[model samples]
Structure formats: C-alpha cells, structure tokens
Target: MLGERILLGPGPSLVPPEVTAAMAAPMVGHMDPDLFPVLEETARLLRQVFQTANELTLAVSGTGTAGMEATLLHMVKPGERLVVCSAGFFADRLIEIGGRIGAEVVRVEAAWGRPIDPADLERALGRLGGGRTTVAAVHVETSTGVLHPIADLARVAHAHDAAILVDAVASLGGADLPTDAWDLDACYSGSQKCLSAPPGMAPVTVHTRTRGRFRPATFYLDLEGLWTYWGAPHGYHHTVPVSLVYAMREALRLVAAEGLPARVERHRRMTRALWAGLEAMGLELLVPEPHRSPTITTVRIPAGADDAKVRTRLLREYSIEIAGGLGPLRGQIWRIGLMGYSCQPKWVLALLGALEAVLTAEGVRLPKGDAARAAAARL
Candidate 1:
C-alpha cells in the first residue's frame, strides 16, 4: 500500500502541479520542428532563471552530476591546476571529478558544517601561484545546509585570473544567484531541487568567456559540442529527454510568472518559519544563522535521542518525510528541506506539528503545541 507523505528532504522536493502536468503531455520526436521551439524556449527561460544572457544556456539529458562533469570536462584540461573548496559532499565530488579529468586538484578545506571562508580561498589560490587554477565551489552545500559566499569567492578567483564554476544544485531557483552580477563563469543546477520538476534534466549556463576558452576533451559530456549543436545549425549531439524538457520548460515558465525575487522571498519566509518552529521545540541548528541555506535547514538532534526512530515515526505515523544527515553527521542532524512548492507555510506547520508529536512521544521534553504555535506566529 502506497502512503501519501510530505517530501521534506533535500531533493527531489515536491514537484509543482503544472510541471507534472507538462511532463504528462504527449512526447514529441527530439528533432521535430514543433519540439525545437520548445527546446529554444527552455533555453531562453533557463537564461532568465540563471540571470545570464549567455548564448549557450541549455539543459543536459542527465542529472546535476552530468552538468558538473560536462563543465569540468570542457573547462579543465589535463595537467591544469584546479582549486576546489571542500565544505561538504558536493564540493568533494567536484574535486573528484576534476581529478578524474587529469587536472591537478587542490583543495581548500573547511569543517563539515561550516561555510568556506573567503580568506581561506584567497590563501589557497595564493599557494597555487596563479596559472591554470580553475576555482570550483558549491553555492549551497546540501549535505550540511550551509550557504557558501559565492560572490566573495568569485572575486577572489577572478583576482587570480581563474574561471569559477559553481554547483548550484540546491540554490538555483530557491535562492538569489545572479550569475552575471556575481561574475560566476559556469554553473549547473538540477531540475528536482528548487525547480519543482522531475530529476532528469540538468540546467546549465556558461559565460561567454568560459565558452571561448573551453575545449571539448570528451565527446558525450562536451559542453562546447553540446553548445554548437544546440545553437545555430542545431546539429544533433544526442537524443534529448523530451518529457523532461517539457517539465523543465513548464517549471521555468512558473518561475518566470512568479518572478525570481518574489519566489526567493517566499522560500526565505518559509525557511524562517521552519527555523522558528524548530527553535521553539528546542532543536539546535547545525550551521549558524548567517551561513544557513534558505532552501534546507539542518537541525541537530538532542543528545541520546534516536534519530532513526524519530524519522521512522514521522514517516509511518504522520506521513511526513524529512532527512538524516550525510557523511560524518549521519546520525546527528535532521535535514528539513523547504524547497520549491514544499516551502509553503502549510507544509512548515504540518512538519513541525508532526515532529513535535514524534519527539514528545519519543520521551523528549518539550512543551506541547509550542512548535506549531511558534511557526504560526511567524506566519
């Protein structure tokens, strides 16, 4: 028996109704003229969402990781030095991918639950001594729910003459990321996270400078090849995922209709409400308030409380699903994602209500009704 449960994890967050409906629409041939317009519209909308006027904005037929691979494969060649900021899992993944591409990977490390400091990044770049250092960072670290200072990082990278790539898998639509304004060269995001769409398409944008410098080292994941195929002559690189493109187009349209600024504000409001409710329940947040991501919040479970038990009860009894921590934080943190449509006030209140009951029943001490009341007060 399938049960209806609220998706409150890092991703694949709740899909908007329109996106789902669009995906259900009839699929068309990848090279059909009618479908070409849809592809073009998708690229245009992605450029708008990414806040870039780049000529090569497009979607890849894979998940966010494919976008990451594509960016590294094209931008960083063998024997070049690539500097990566490691604050969490995604950053580590970037370093790994860079290593696989035969780039000399240098890491600027930060503690698991902390954001990478701009000074540290500068120091790392200084140690690398300039030439061939491609700086990479995770804009929003989903593993720890920490928001890195991308603008400052970009400034530091630019000073060293390094092109910066951002993995915005969790931040793209939910947070304010102005690619051009921030001077980010290349960035990739997933459809399932803040886009409120299914998880097949990876939306990516590359600056003109990056595009001009990039060389295709791999055929399938080559950004330059994909760009040329999608642009101008529109030569075929690969058969595009038709339904996923439809979903992305619809999702981007919803984002356009809502306006990026207003959508970001809504996410902020819902996140604040979740934070307030968790605070009222006496749960401690993993990251400091200044570094928290608006899309996801990681709360530290109280000492001696069973994390698995609490999460299981929330799922089985209340039909609500939150997440446990990753890596070193596995059993210590509860990740509550207020992403896209799931970032609604109703979901926040409902999650808090369910969590309160579960924790209270688990023999944790907290005043009854405080969490829901605190969340409501925020609303």
Candidate 2:
C-alpha cells in the first residue's frame, strides 16, 4: 500500500515517497550541531519556494491556521485596526482571529465563490479614515476555489498606509504569487496543500521593514524568536520537529526541481482538463473561469445529486477522495484539488471516471463515460 491513495481532496495532498522517506530517516536533536546545517538549508529552500527575499521566512509548528494566528497576532497588536476583505471561509477566519486578539476588526465582504475586489478594500479603509492599518485577505480561497490578485490589493493597502497580509494557504507553491514582487508585507501557507508535505508545518514570510517594528503577541510563535532559532546565534526557542522538517525540506526540493513556473503550469493544465471533463457532464463550476483557482476546483452539485451519496460512492467504490464544500457553501458544491504531486494526467482522468460512475450510481442521469472521454481529449 505504498502508493494506494488518490488524494484528490482540498488539502493534505498526496505525499511523495521521497518526502515520507526523508521523514523516516533517524530523528535528530533540534539544536544538535549536525542538524543546524539541515535547518539552514531548509530555510534557504523555503525562501526560494515562497518567492520572497524577506529575512523572516520560516516554518511555524501546527497547521495553516497557526500561521494565520501568528501573523495577525504578531503584526496587528491590540487596539489596532485590521481590515479583512473576506470572500470565503478562510477570509472570515482572519476576522475571527483578529477579533479574538483584541484588534478592532472591520470587514469588507464579497459573495462566496468570488474574489475580493480591491475597490471595496479602498472603500473600507476610506471609511476607517486611514492611518497606520492592516489589510488581510485570502489569496486563493480554498472554500470557493477563487483566486484574488494580491498585487492590486497590496497597492491599495499601501496607499492607505497599511501593511498587506495575505493567507496563501491554498494557493502557495501551486499558484504564481510573487511575495516580494507583489509587495506583500507578510504571507502564510500550509504544508499539506500545494507543498505535498504533512499537515503540521505552516511556512510564513515577513518583510524586513517590520523587522524591529513590533514583538509577537504569543511567545511560542514570536517571529523574532523563531528567526533567532532558525538563523544566527542558533538559539533554542523550543523543540523543533526534526522529522517534519525533513519532510518539508524534501517537498521543497521537489518544488525546486520541478521549477516554480513549470509546477504552476502543470497545476493549471490539469485544472483545464478537469473543467473540460466536468463541463462535458453538464456540471457547472462554482466559480467563473477567469477567477478559478488552479489548485482546487469547486463544482456545483446538480439538481438530482446527493452530495454525501456521491462523495461516499466515490470513496467506497473507486477508492478516490474529494471534499465537500465548507461554511456557507456546504452541501452545495464539491471541492476537488489538483495540487503538488497529485496534479497529473492519470489522477485527473481517474477522478473524472470515478465521478461519472458515482454520479450515475447516485441516480443523477448523464451519459456514461462522457467525462472520461472529454478529459482525455483535453489532456
């Protein structure tokens, strides 16, 4: 059962054997002399994968949610204003975390399955009367499979003298988001999504401009402390997960070897083929083609289909896995991920065939094997 899964769900993408094997090697001390070099190399590779020259790039313990909390709590202190442009579930998550941290949270929301518009953000700040502020947004909303343009949004945030923070949990590594080139102040992403690693580590990058500006609210997630441990002085902040580090390093190596542009292109190519197959089955996409995300695709559940039944059949009958929608979109759409190692022709074709069979089994009438033929034509 070494490679038994077809992990086509929204997250925790299929982990390649290389990454898992790296984790299986002998575990080492967090601060051991021999291990420091591995840590340094990991940091270097992280910067490359993140597409940022920011000096604060490093992986935080826990999942992507931890990355979101650490970033907001660290940058937006108590009593500060955090303007969140919410489009889907993860965007709303930023608001929740910001409010819990004692920041004055203001929301500028878009309908689900759409990207956050920059004009709305400008209006939100204009109403806030614009001082030193923060604008938080989700770069690619995994819940809705929509991609937001970070560079334009960052421009508006800077115009209002605000630091722009983006949640790239679903977009990073698979999508083309140049953190430094786009002028993002900070961004965080999950290891399980596009990185094809385990679900514990969250990689985040911070700008050098905020180097000495503020201290982290939480001690364990303090950016300065984490940097000190990952970098110079090599001080011990806490016990780092050496095995996950190995897995993350191998994953990043895969990202590098495939080349960033080509990796993103592969994800996009698979997305197009998936869309062609789904559309040929008379299924509609939750989001429009222009705003669709390359990493995850959200499909509307047809009139005669039962979401749970279709998904269960896919799992039980085909041994394939896909996710149901989240938050407001729950039970309305199915989230299918084409990410990292899982984005390939074989996986795409397999899911299409499985979906066709399951939808028919669930009594949703459609031509048999149409999806597979359409997908083959595109692929």
Candidate 3:
C-alpha cells in the first residue's frame, strides 16, 4: 500500500533504496569507535556536497528547523541588530527566530512568488549605517518555489561588515550552491528534501570566521560547543542520532557517486521538463522562470476549480501526492516537488500524466494529452 502512493510533495520526498537500507545497518553507540568513522565520512561528504572547505560542518540531530534555530541562537545575541529578507513563509521564519533571540529584527519584505531584490538589501544595509547586523535570507523559498540570489545578497551583507546566514533547507543538494564561492557565512539544510534521506538530521556548516563570533548559549543546540566536542578530544556533547547519521552518510555517498554537476543537471533537466509539461497543460506557474526553484514548482489552480478536490482525486484515484500552497497562497496553487530520488524522468512523466487525467476529469479544458506529450518530447 505504501509503495502504491507517489510522493510529489514539497519534502520528505522519495528516499532511495540504498539510503533506506543504510538506516537498517546494525546500530552502535553514538560515540563508538565504529561510528566515529561514519561521522567523519559524513562530514567530509557533506563538505564536498556543499562545496565548502569549512571545518565546522556537521549534522544536527533534528529536522531543518532545528538547524535554523541552532545557527540563529549561536550567532545572534540579545539586543543585536539583525536584518532579514523575507520573500515567503520560510524567510519569515528567520525574522521570527531572530526576534525570539532578542535581536532587533528589521525585515525587508518582498511579494510572494518573487525573489528578494539585491538592491532592496543594499538599501536596507545603507539605512542601517554599517553597524553590526546579522543578515539572514532564504536561499530557496520552498513555499513559493522561488530561489533567492544569495551571491548578490552576500556581497551586500559583507559590505556592511555583517555575517550572512542562509536557509538552504530546500535547495542544498538538489541545487547548485557553492557556499565558499558565494561567500555564505553560515548555511543549513535538511536531509529529506534534496539528500533523499529520512527527515531526522539537519546538515549545517559554519565558516571559521563566523564560528569565532558565536558564544555558547544552550548546551545542546550550541554549535560552537558541539564543534569543540566533535572536533578536538572528541568529548561527548549529546547522543547523536546514530541510525539517521547512517542514512545521511548513505545519502551523501549517493550524491558523491552521482557527481555534483551531474546531480545538479539532472534536477535542472527534470524541472525544465516539468515546467514545459505544466505549461502545455495550461497550468500557470506561480514564480517566473528566472526565480523558479529547481526542486519545487508551484502551479496556479485555475479559477473556479477546487484545488482540494483535484488533490484528493490525485491521491485517491492515481495514488499521487502533491502539496497545496501554504499561508497567503493556500488553495490557490499546487506545490509539486522534483527532489532527490524523486527527480527523474519516470516520476516527471508519471506526475504529468496523472495530473492531466485528473484535470480533464474535472472538466478543465486542456489540450488532449498535451502534458504527457510535452514531457515525452523533452525526454
């Protein structure tokens, strides 16, 4: 029954058989000699995947949100000035977390389905008068399927002597993000979205320059403390999620085997095929082409069509699952993901074919068999 349903939603997308099997490997103590090599190898693979030489990269024992909290808590102190660029729901989360950490949060807002403008970020920095500010932005806004420009924003942040933190939760492995080349100070992501692992670990990397500024606040979420323990004499900080790490190690190994460039190209190709198919079906894309994320696409539901009804039919009839929009765009758009193992020609074709059938059954006027034909032509 579980195998019958297709996962076309935003996250917790399809996990590969190798990754799933790795999780079932015999478990050992978190600090066992056998597991240390696995931890070390996981860090090495993550660094290669993230395209960073930073020594502080490791997996936090929670979901992507935990990585966000850990990065924010360690970096921002009480009464510090923080600037956030919120283009969608997840970016708004940065502002909320900053506020909770007692930072004087200043937000630069953009409309949903659009990327944050670099000029706006520059203007906000200019207004701040070059004081110490923690600049935060989302690398990929999953809710609206928009990819924000991190390189330009990082330059604006650095010009003001600020550290830039990015939420790459939805973009990391599936998207081509060169952390060092982009000058990103800190970035965090999840295993489930692009890594094709179970949703348990959050991979985080903090540059040495950024790591020096953070003092430990909470013991467990304190990245600096974790670094000290994980790095040097190997003191025990907390019980690491052993099985999840095993799974993440396997996921990274798969990414490494595929090669980053090939993996990235695969995602781009699948996304392009998906866009072409959806466009052929007369389904409008929420984000413009330039800002669309490769891993996820949000398609606008036609006026007078019931979004929930179509989604239900897709699930019950075709055994396919795609997400509805969240927050302001709820019920107006369908969020479909082509991520990790799910980003393939077979899945793309399957989703388009099923969606075409569902939309046609609901009396929407689409060219007969257009979606499937377009996808096949692309393939």
Over 4 Å off in model 2, which ranges? 1-3
lDDT of each: 0.88, 0.89, 0.89
**Residue 209, candidate 1: C-alpha displacement in angstroms:** 1.0
Compose the digit string of candidate 3's lDDT tens values, residues 254-332.
Answer: 9999999999899998999999999998889999999999999999998667899999999999888899999999988
Write model 1 residue lDDT over 121-189, tens digit each, in one string.
898888776467789999999999999999999999999899999999999999999999999889999
Q: Which lDDT tens digits does candidate 2 get at residues 179-200? A: 9998999999999999999999
Can you give the TM-score per candidate against the true fold? 0.97, 0.97, 0.97
- Regions of candidate 3 where Cα sits further than 4 Å from its true position: 1-4
Ten-residue stretch with the least lDDT total in model 3: 226-235
Q: Report the Cα lDDT for residue 243, model 2.
A: 93
Ranking the candidates on lDDT from highest down gives 2, 3, 1
What are the RMSDs of all candidates, in order?
A: 1.3, 1.4, 1.3
Q: Kindly give the stretch of ten consecutive residues in candidate 1 with the minimal lDDT sum.
A: 210-219
